[model samples]
Target: MPLLRARPALLYAAVSLACPEGALADEREEVRTVLFGSLDAGRSTFVSAGAKVAPGGIGRDGFVTLATLGYGLRPERDWWGDPRGKAGLTPPRTLRHTVQAGAVAGWQWVRDWGVAALFAGPEIAFEVLDSPGTRKLPTPRIGARVQGELWARPTETTLLTTTLIAGTARWSAWGRVSWGIRVPEWSAAYLGPEAALYADRTGYRKWSLGLHATDFAIARLSFRVSAGWVYEEQIRRPGAYGTLTAWLPL
Candidate 1:
């Protein structure tokens, strides 16, 4: 998916939101923070840090919020302006910097259902090329997401999320249906999948498919993986990426 190309962060969010759960209720308040960094084989590097503070488990009357910032050291810019095949041509230099901020707030119900609002804005700055004809450009996106859970259980959760974007420029509107499954308590594993569609002024903008997984490797350390595929017109880019995070509970 075009999104899979430049927006790996959202894919991480999908898995992060789906994987964690509560085993026993704790009366004391708790704060958990995670910091992680990754370098793709393509020579792009990223770093992000965030926290989740939940008074009542993350599923009940509390919120889960995170903010992430990253840049691509040698980014291929073909996926920027046009998702369709029309923009197949890539920029001369593969370097770009990106800044992103996002937040999500919600009221958890009975440890299963939830209502939340999500807002995110990302700005991109392309490195200038030597050739005047290859001058750089800027791209920014402002968007919001409204999500609600329809059914939830100790072992599974289902959510319907809708996203809208509007800014100094035009963007895409999309909706997603996501489902998660928890492994047997003794195993401590999680898996989730999501399907989404985007629409624009032209027509069906893009269709995306995503997957998430988490496994505990040792004490206070966990592994996370996510990947997605986006289809727009005759172009398709399926990207696979993820992160491994270690947690410190304070």
Candidate 2:
């Protein structure tokens, strides 16, 4: 299967929308903010911050809507030499940076047995490549993204989720099966297996074990962590990868 390549912050936001009954919800309407970061084994890193606002009267009978805005940065290194060669003076690595800003309107509906949500919006980004020998100016690009999520609860303690995110530039899809576990003083804990596919030049696939926690604090907050290996068909060696995200409601 292919792995989805969505930004971790956006993925967390989609998960929050899918599981509205979890720690992301409050009795009253308010704005929720989130800060997230992820580092991959390939030396790629991303950081993002976003906020969602839910107005009163938008949610009724298991249906809700929210307005969201976010900004993200991706910084990665590109080396000029082959790693398989003997140790010698290696060429300097280039630093490539991508900055993005976007907004989306999301709608979610929940029933006794399942939940569904979708969000779509436009984004603009700038990319800058700083090579060892040359400096490049920021190049601008415009794109749009559409993301959908579904959650099904077969039993009181088991939940299944599938998410797909597609955009003008890239696409990714993932699925997870979680079993709710008992944790002292915590509102919820889920242990699960997750798999993902990304439509990229290298066709990356990810398999990992994941844990999701909600309401662990007195205030509204959630945490997710995943560790696993990533394989690319074109690459000879697979890489180990891990991601941790903390979301706080303010």
Q: Which candidate ranks first by lDDT, i.e. highest? A: 2
Residue-by-residue lDDT tens digits, candidate 1, 112-181: 2333433344322223322334445644655543333333332222233333433222233445555555
Q: Estimate each model's TM-score.
A: 0.50, 0.64
Best of the candidates, TM-score = 2
The local distance difference test score of each candidate is 0.39, 0.45
| Root-mean-square deviation of Cα positions for candidate 2 versus the true structure, in angstroms | 7.8
User: What lDDT, from 0 to 1, does candidate 1 have?
Assistant: 0.39
Model 2, 1-250: lDDT tens digits are: 0011111112234443222234223322243333333333343444555554443322222233333333323222234323422345444444546565656667756455555667778766665656553455746767776767765555555556676766553333334444343343444444555565554322434444444442233344456555666554333356665555455544
Q: Which stretches of candidate 2 lie over 4 Å from their true place?
A: 1-42, 57-95, 132-135, 169-187, 200-219, 232-236
Q: Model 1: clashing residue pairs?
A: 1-230, 1-237
Q: Per-residue lDDT for 187 in model 2? A: 46
Query: Model 1 misses residue 43 by how many Å?
Result: 11
